[model samples]
Target: MKRRTAREKALQALFQIDISSTEPSAAIEHVLEGERSDDYLSKLVNGVIEHLDEIDQLIKAHLEKWSLERLATVDRNLLRIAVFELKYEHDEVPEKVVLDEAIEIAKLYGDDQSSKFINGVLSKVKQHLF
Candidate 1:
């Protein structure tokens, strides 16, 4: 599977975890069935969950006037995945690539403003982290 496809899966898994409050392991297993699973996608999903607090903090810091709870769940988690890729997975992925993929995902699964919102927040994250 392509990277964007993997990201879409990861986004869905994250969304599932958020909506159902299910365990990550089960959530991942449930989502990965019938789909190709790879180390990169696995790492992305698990890493985002593992570092959720830190990721959320970064997003929370960048989003002025919009709290994490107030943001749409899809937009919030999409930012989390992109930020995680930008920060912790830098060796394997480039910042622009992560941001681009995120913007595409946002356009598909998020509100009309999601792409702009994600870009703005991630730009701030890139400035601080890189």
Candidate 2:
């Protein structure tokens, strides 16, 4: 099987966290097992969770009319993963690359407009932060 991207793995872990009220570390451990577990994915999931509050704050700051609570769980987590990569994990991935991957993931797992929503939110974040 082709190796999944870190963003993809992070999305899954965040989805798990959203659905279950589990701790982020526990969720990361659960998701990072079997064939899915890998260094990149583990790092991304951990990194995002490590700075979740900061990432959420950045997301909320740029969200305009939408509250983070109002966003679809998948989209909210997608933005978290993207923002985490953009701000803190810059050494591992480029900003545009992370944003593009987030959009694609949102399209696949999020709502019909998830890609657009993620793009808009991440674009504002990028402008404000970078």
Candidate 3:
């Protein structure tokens, strides 16, 4: 699957896992809906889950007034995916590409302010990390 599709599927799976406490495998399967699974999609979901605490901490640190839990589910998980790519997958994908993708995904899946909000926080994160 394309990386964009992988990110979108990863976001859906993460949203499911967050809202329902669903198992990771179950969430991934649910999102796939019989389509062939993509390696990047699995890597994203599993990577975020594996590094959740650290990811949350990075997000929490960058947040202005918002707590991690207070952010919209879509925004929170989108940030996680972007941050995972930014921090861990830096060699594979450029940091700017990660940021741009997250903002675009937010525009699609998030509320009116989400893209801006994600862009702002992730800018800080990119600065801090790099």
- Which candidate, 2 or 3, would have the higher lDDT against the true structure? 3
lDDT of each: 0.88, 0.81, 0.96
Clashing pairs in 2: none
lDDT of 2 by residue, 7-94 (tens): 6767888889778867777776776675545676766777877888999999999987889999888888889888988898777678
Could you arrange the candidates by TM-score from highest to lowest?
3, 1, 2
TM-score of each: 0.95, 0.87, 0.99
Which 10-residue span in candidate 3 carries the lowest summed lDDT? 64-73
Task: Identify the leading candidate in terms of TM-score.
Answer: 3
Identify the candidate with maximal lDDT. 3
| RMSD to truth, every model | 1.1, 2.1, 0.5
Off by over 4 Å in 1: none
Which digits, one per residue and each the tens of the lDDT, describe model 1 over residues 6-124? Answer: 89888988999998897877777787886656676788889999999999998888988888999898998899899999989899899999999999999999989999999999999
